[model samples]
Target: MSAWIEMISDEDADADLRAALDLARTPHGTVDNVMRVHSLRPNTMRGHVVLYRAALHDAANTLPTWLQETISSYVSLLNDCGYSLANHWKNARHLIGDDARADAIWAALEARAPERVFAGAELALMRYAEKLTLEPGRMVAADVQALKAAGLDDGAILEANQIVGYFNYVNRCLNGLGVSTAGDIVGYYAENEAE
Candidate 1:
């Protein structure tokens, strides 16, 4: 853990932070460093928890959870945030339920060539995520039009956009905070959304 970060211990948490912390805890009763960093402002922690479930784990998502994790992992890779990459990659693999296929997809992503595992709208979404993460200022309407041209409806496009945006946000937060990767939490989005 970075010396700069003053993460609140569970014993020291106040009612407000404790409430947000409880909501963000994993099924295994652990809270990720990514969320723990928001201890100083518990509302942001609560917002982060809500957005996390809504954007990536909700049953209403038009984009599949596996794809959301893949997008998250890919964006994490682009941002050089190993914490998010490792965490979300595990979810992606579990949701995929085929390590071989998941490995191939991850390998392709690591090589910065998602084209090997995706085509059409899926491929377009990966490319868009790469561009959005690497060069957000350059994004324009044409980028979104390309997704539509590739076959994603507005709802799906919105989901993909939110996934990319969310990863970018969390990735920056994790990386910027200098969070330690030791004993990092996994299976964050593994539980069924119906739960």
Candidate 2:
């Protein structure tokens, strides 16, 4: 499905917006529809690009990139956002490099029973993600304590928190705008997010 609103094209962008669009471009050199939704406000688009890169692609994140991709897919699934789910699932599959393993994880995520495939700190974080995504108001400090008890240090918990929050934000943006995987290349920007 196309966006519910009009999106600005590269031809219509000024120098500054053109720069922002450049950063958001897929490897195909075209802006993905989700990022294009922010074209009306160049600054917002730029912020999205920066946040996305840092949250999921930054080398400094202690969480493995594959795990981040899985977290993104999980959040999208919770939000019923096909665009982000399909895109990040593809990315996660490629990074995981084992079709069977990735499919098992996908199965668990699809079942909304992360415990089926995850354990320990990973399981705790997935549970936290579910609670935060589905019941933002019900969360309490006990959630953080649970993560800590599961062996996640404060830094890892924060990283997982940022990833969950980022995917929730992206999921709502795409869902609210009617973004879909129609013409976009699934996972095209996964490895090339730094541009």
CA lDDT scores, all candidates in order: 0.86, 0.88
| CA deviation > 4 Å runs, candidate 1 | 1-3, 188-195
TM-score of each: 0.91, 0.92
Off by over 4 Å in 2: 189-195
Model 1 lDDT at residue 29: 84
Q: Which ten residues in a row have the lowest lDDT in candidate 2?
A: 186-195
Q: For residue 144, what is the lDDT in candidate 2?
A: 96
Output the lDDT of residue 30, model 1.
82
Give one digit per residue, the lDDT tens place, for model 1 in 11-77.
8999988998999887778887778889989999999999988888789887877888889899999
lDDT of 2 by residue, 48-159 (tens): 9999988887888998888888888899999999999889888888888899998899999999999998999889989999999999999999999999999989988888
Clashing pairs in 1: none
Clashes of each: 0, 0
